[model samples]
Target: MRRLVLTSLLLAIVVIGLGAYTRLTHAGLGCPDWPTCYGLIDVPETSIQIAAAEQAFPERHVEPAKAWNEMIHRYFAGSLGLLIAVIAFVSIKLRFSKSSKVRYPIFLPLCILGIVTFQAALGMWTVTLKLMPIVVMGHLLGGFTTLCLLFLLYLRINARRINTQGEKLAESQLKKYSSYALIGITILTAQIALGGWTSSNYAAMSCVELPICQGDWLSDLSFEQSFDLIPPNQESYEFGHLAHNERVTIHVSHRFGAIITGAFLAWLAITIFLKAKTPSIKNTATILLSLLVIQISLGVSNIWFSLPLKVAVAHNLVAAGLMLSLIALTYKLRQNSEESLYE
Candidate 1:
């Protein structure tokens, strides 16, 4: 079970990296459609082949770079799907048969499977529709949500089977900490969503100066243009688009959100340090704080250097990693309290 958990965690991390690669390389349209690349199971091989396919659908404007990026992401995603399916299936086989009480073990993974499938579909639509911001944000959120569910499943599967000899009741106060962690997770998730929105909508460069969007110290910004549902282009929907409004709109929000998330994480870290004597809980807070600092650095760098692909992708990967770390931390907290209760 420990091995399984470790494997799942590694696979999830790989998925995060691949996702970053897809965006950094601007390959969201590499495959051009979900579950398939250029209407094939795998990406096309030659320039002629790509040209022929592009000729078939000239309006969609398929580019080789984007196609490969999208296709590779899908390939990795497909691999993850197969892996999780195996995990869920084997879990069912091992933990349940005729009268096992572990009926819910399969439920969480199954839900993840279903959601990933939907997310795969959304990925296709995101490209075909020419990178709609809302859909892309939805896809990003779905991907992170999938990560959380997988971690939960991994934790549940690795739960130690202990013989309780007149176990005492667990402290209900543990639930309070769980609630606090839940709040942190919620806030972090929202920040991730905004990050995706800022990325998909090309809002990252909206405020290049940073800390102060639009080169001002807290200007009265107009989200009317900032919140445009469509992906901002070099033309159309003018007015501070890329040259002015773009950096002003996105950088500030993204930076502010990171600070908020980091602040909450800091508070959580202090709480754990003071009250959570368990090694696992304390280590979780430490990991959480470490990731928070890294994430903040990535965000600022993305702006300072003008949103390079590598930096942007690293930013996204770190966000996903941060989420995974939090999930593990949450489960570790649960494990600590459970052991204390049952001890």
Candidate 2:
């Protein structure tokens, strides 16, 4: 079960990276179909295969490179699903074993499996829906959430193993900061969602300048259109009508959210360093602070350089890492608090 959990964690990380790459390269709709690329197991490259693909997807031209990118993402996602399924089964088996050290309920692994299945559906809709902003953002969030849950499960399992051997921490060291850390997680999640929305709507290029948007602290913007999730009746999978002002609304809102999230995290890190009793807690805090800095730098570079592909993709990846760090810090605090109950 440990091996399975570790495998899933690594694969989940790859999926996140590949997902970001696909989106950055505009390959979300590269296949124009789900579970297959141009109606084949792989992208069509030969003349014969290209002709067949063109015939089948007449309206969608065959781009071999983009199609391969999407298919690779799908394949990795499918492999991750299999790993999670194994985890669910093994965990359920361990639940009945009196000798097992695992403390988490069987339901957690099962829940992750269910989430992976739902994520698969979202992946399909991402293509069939023509990269609709809402669905795309949801897909991105779902991927991150899956990774977060799996990582937490890994930590819980290992911590439980250590505790079973009587090595658990003895005091409620981070009790005072627990709630604040959780609140920081919530705000960071919202900021990530805003980032997803901005990316999906192609709003990142709206300003190209940092502190101010379009050379103005405030500009004419439309929140309604910017946040619109309603799609037209037409089957065409294209971006909904969005004016420059609406895009600006999304871009600026994401910027504001970043400011709030960054400030809160900075305060949380300082407090942790000064008050945390354990080296593990202090190290997690330090890592979180470092990731926060890198994430901010990526965000700025993305804009300053007019959304270069590599920087943009790194921004998305670092955002995931930031979430993982917060999840770890908060989970550790909870574990310590629980352990203090007996002493």
Candidate 3:
């Protein structure tokens, strides 16, 4: 079960990276259909197949490269969903089995299964709705949530093995920083959502300049349209429907969100590092700090390098990494707190 969970977790990361790649490459609508590419199981490769695909979905021509990208993401995401189901089944079986001594986490696995199910729905919506910003953002957040939950499940499953070597922190110390860690997670989540919104709306490149947006962005701010969940009616939201000003508003807002999130997480990491008595706790904090820095650097590189495909994908992946590191820190703190309670 542990190995299964770990595999699912790694696959979740791959799904996210592939999703980012698909989005960055303007392949969100590559299939023009859910769970299939132009009514086919795979991309239409043959000339005849391509002709048939184009004939069926005349509005969406067959771009083999883009279609393959979307389909590949779907394939991995589907596999991860199946793996989660197996994890849930194994968890329930273990819970009911009298022969098993280990306390498997039944609820967490079940919850993960539920989330993955919804994530599948979101994935469909992402394509069917023509990359609607809200749906896309929700899908991105869903992926992050699934990743964090899987990491949490892994920590829970290995709690005994993990805590065996590390010196436990005092309950008082744990209490002091747990809330801060939780806040850090919350802030990072919001920031990630903002990033998704920016990307989904094609606003990532709106602000080319560093430190701020272009040409008196303050005067050109259009908050209402930028954050509007439901924009004016359109046949499709592909390539984004927002004006330059609106996109700039979203991009600038994401930039501000990054600054706030980075500052808060940095403070939390440093505080935890200094206050932690256990090497394990301190090491977790150190890793969190390192991820924070890497994430920030990636953010800047996205702007500096004109949002290169590799950098953009790395940005998304590192955000996941940063979130996971924070989860690790929080798990260590909470585990120590519980141990201290019993001690």
Best by TM-score: 3
Q: Superposing all C-alpha atoms, what RMSD in Å does each candidate have to the true structure?
A: 4.3, 2.5, 2.0
Regions of model 1 farther than 4 Å from truth: 1-5, 60-62, 98-104, 161-175, 217-220, 228-247, 335-343
lDDT of 2 by residue, 1-343 (tens): 6678988998999999999999888888889887888888888999999999899999899988888889999999999999999899888888878896545457779999999999999999898878888889999999998999998888777775556665444337666687998999899999999998988887888887757886653656778768878655446535434778888899899999999999999999888878877777888899999999999999999888888888988898899889999988887777762452221
Tell me the RMSD of model 1 versus the true structure.
4.3
Cα-based TM-score, every candidate: 0.83, 0.94, 0.96
Clashes of each: 10, 0, 0
TM-score, cand. 1 vs. native: 0.83
- Positional deviation of 273 in candidate 2, in angstroms? 0.9
Model 2 pairs whose backbones collide = none
Candidate 2's displacement at residue 335, Å, is 1.4
Whole-model Cα lDDT of every candidate shown, in order: 0.69, 0.84, 0.88
Off by over 4 Å in 2: 98-104, 164-173, 234-240, 337-343
Model 3 alpha-carbon drift over 4 Å, by segment: 166-171, 337-343
Cα lDDT for residue 120, model 1? 77
Query: Positional deviation of 200 in candidate 3, in angstroms?
Result: 0.5
